[model samples]
Target: MRAEPESAPYARLGGEDAVRKLVNRFYDLMESEAQWQTPLRAIHPQDLSESKEKLFLFLSGWLGGPDLYVQRFGHPRLRARHGAFPVDDRARDQWMACMLQAMREVEMAPELYVHLRDAFQRTADFMRNR
Candidate 1:
């Protein structure tokens, strides 16, 4: 268990191990799930290794754990990094579906899941360029 209070999303999430599990599950679903085979999976690289690591790092910081992403890559520059991708409603929805399912599969607490879901929704909405 993490030293952070249980109320901390990172601690409630079981710290680094849980975060890794969530990221892996999210990418696995995107790769294997038929529903995400279009724009969502298509937007990703043929090799998901880099993509998975980036997300794991980003989520680690975003969820209030160590800021590994920023430490290693500097500021996330989220919009700038994702600007090249053609993100639309369909792609956003597909991403959300996979993430929501991954969270559930990882057995995240309902309250924390809802909180992260809302946060992710806003982020995904902003990612939409069309």
Candidate 2:
């Protein structure tokens, strides 16, 4: 029923709607699973509303959709942006676990899930500052 071009991860993943869902699910786990994710969650504001919007916008561009994040906020110097957070090895692993849980809950396709898991793991690790 859809006519999206091949190879666009954004489209393949169901566009903005799916991306938003993924972001929401990721944050939900991060909030709900506080026992293990406390350190990572602490880096965020008490209210996650802004964080959700930011993640949605960033992912929209990162996934090959319209460049909403760059258009609105300029280049995503991700490392620089995240430098304030104390992301050590534990934080990276916990973040990856939260993301994997989110992807599974959102029922991502097997191939896409694997691809995203690997990519997210690398990205999460890259954010480690300690």
Candidate 1 residue-wise lDDT, 1-130, digit = tens: 2345667788889998999999999998898889899999988899999999999999988888888899999999988898898899999999999999999999777899899999999999988987
**Candidate 2 lDDT tens digits, 1-130:** 2344657788878888999999999899998986655688888899999999999999887877878889899999999999888888888888888888888987657898888888888888788998
Give me the runs in candidate 2 sitting further than 4 Å from their true place. Answer: 1-4
What shift in Å separates residue 91 of candidate 1 from its native position after superposition? 0.5
Q: What is the lDDT of residue 24 in candidate 1?
A: 96
lDDT computed for candidate 1: 0.91
Clashes of 2: 0
Clash pairs (backbone) in predicted model 2? none
Best by lDDT: 1
Query: What is the Cα-based lDDT of residue 84 in candidate 2?
Result: 85
Residue clash pairs of candidate 1? none
Worst 10 residues of 1 by lDDT: 1-10
